[model samples]
Target: MSENNSSQDSRSRIARRVFPDGVDPDPRFTLANERTFLSWIRTALAFIGGGIAVEAFTSEIFGSGLRATLSIVLMVIGFILAAGAAVRWHRIESAMRRKTSLPLPLIIPIVSLASALGAGLLVLVFAGLL
Candidate 1:
């Protein structure tokens, strides 16, 4: 086989191994799931970026300990978010392939609460309350 065909075959094999139980889903649903996954990845990156920015720019606004803690918290949250996104994507794809009702989006409320609290902390810090 050509190199491209070989690569494609490898991907297909891996995909089949990873998604062994499900039949091929509708193309549109699959694409939408991918988009949702990408958006979660983007949110993860944003959190990581916030961590980097905090560590780089907060020397004057925050004391050393608080600064490091906030940065670590943001980055750790980012990692968790990324991991959760992968698992969620897999679960969602499996549900669709199984033709079952969609799973409840358990991540939504958790992410919303985290984002709100994080933003609130930033607001307090900037307002000289922290």
Candidate 2:
């Protein structure tokens, strides 16, 4: 009986978080939100894997330094994006439950970081550093 009560309470809390302000949010939306979060995680893993691939597979051909740096940076970006995605997903879900507008993430930072990485790689490749 106690276990059942605890489980029920947990479900209630989840439902409350997922349907705050009595907005009558659909259960399907919750499942979609979960899927989106999972997608972000997969994307992050791919980025990290790409980085490793560059170092492992291309190391013999392209050598090291510039290419290695690019790979590592990409991997770092992936990790950052993954973490950002998790936080954003939760925030969005909670805001939806509360019927509040979602917050804008750090788009400028993300863009600048990506641009810088790309430009650096381009310069290194053009200069024959890679």
Give the number of the best model, judged by lDDT: 1
lDDT of 2 by residue, 1-130 (tens): 3666556553566665454443444778768878977887887788789889878888665658856787888799788879877887777777777677767865337847786877787787778886
Please, what is the TM-score per model? 0.85, 0.67
Error of 2 at 96 (Å): 1.4
Candidate 2's displacement at residue 6, Å, is 9.5
Q: Write the per-residue lDDT of candidate 1 for residues 32-68, one digit (tens) a residue.
A: 9999999999999998999999999989889999899
Whole-model Cα lDDT per candidate?
Answer: 0.86, 0.73
**Model 1 stretches astray by more than 4 angstroms:** 1-11
